[model samples]
Target: MVLPGVYAPQEDTELLAGALSDEPLPPGAAVLDVGTGTGALALEAARRGGRVTAVDVSWRAVCAARLNATRAGLPLRVRRGNLFDPVRGESFDLILTNPPYVPAPDGTRPRGPARSWDAGHDGRLVLDRICREGPELLRPGGVLLVVQSALSDPDRTLGLLRTAGLKAAVIRRRRIDFGPVLRGREHWLRHRGLLSATDDKEELVVVRAELPV
Candidate 1:
């Protein structure tokens, strides 16, 4: 299955795999992997003895993830629907996601292909939604693992999470240069119509936030 428009699953898969491989999992834990691109993270959880359900809005992504999970000798539930749509009336001990959070060209216009990558005009479209909706999905002491480029506003994202009643914090950071993606970024910022782009040294932040509210 060819998942077009969706950003390719590379770093997220690698990060998720590494995280899951580090230790033995708690018994019979349930996990929710949103925007599970290649089903790699979902598989990682399953491989670690977690009962995982992965959902993607892209049918192609869903098909590919299902196939990948099968090939890896891991059983996973793959659903094709918008974020949080496939699983309703459900809660999990963990939720993992690598959402599209590239801030758009303007504060109003999406900059690039976004079948899966465009978070919103502010680049927090999927992210904020997750924060707003995540509380309901967690199992009291549940955790949410999110990874995103620094272009996405970490402060705002964390604030939103806490406001939504969850305690959020950064778990990891990597200084990644976005010169490739933000080509002409300076020019974009110079525009009178848009807000100035924030200069961040960190390329990405991998966060693990716990829910208490």
Candidate 2:
């Protein structure tokens, strides 16, 4: 399901088809998928019986997701806009994002159409913005799921969620070797005591947090 300008969805994005445990999504759910590169999560939710709004800042991604949805004969509302702007004033029972979380050099915007895959400087540009906006975009009792690399600051992400008034939790984790850029950012995060050895080397995490009902 690789789309225009996007090389492909990452392995972790495919793993989301399991929905954290091969569990079925509750019927009639309203889901929003941010950075819907290959629309994997959005399409998966549709298959599980939820209505979905799939959004990507990249126009290519939006068109591709729409095509993917149409090809599957699935009904999905695909739109193009940055972050949560396109879906403003809307809330979802489930929100999923595989945001760009790569840490680029200071004052640099990493070049790539892996728009859904590249996290900006310090791995927080898109991730931080997402966390800060989650409480407003999610309905009570809704869940927000994220699959991100250890290259990003999980603790910081958790803090951002909590500060936004959500009950955050880490529901899953895995290890994937960091890329050269991420490998370098690890030093800064580790020096700040953000990266943990307990999670194992090159560990990445998929977190789930619930908004209070």
Q: Best TM-score goes to which candidate?
A: 2
Q: Write the per-residue lDDT of candidate 1 for residues 1-213, one digit (tens) a residue.
A: 335655575654566555555434686799899988778778878977899999987777788888888778887989888789888899998888888776666555353345465555567878888888877899888888888766677887788888877888877676644444555454553353333446533367776778774
Point out where model 1 deviates above 4 Å: 1-6, 16-24, 106-113, 184-186, 189-202
Q: How far is candidate 2 from the true structure (C-alpha RMSD, Å)?
A: 3.2
- Any idea what lDDT model 1 has? 0.73
lDDT tens per residue, model 2, 1-213? 675577476556765555544544688888999888878788888988898999887777888888889899999999889889998999999999888776555526655563455566567878888898877999989888887766678888888898888888777776665655456666665665656655336666777877999
lDDT of 2: 0.76
Clashes by residue pair, model 2: 100-118, 100-119, 101-119, 102-119
**What pairs collide in candidate 1?**
176-203
lDDT of each: 0.73, 0.76
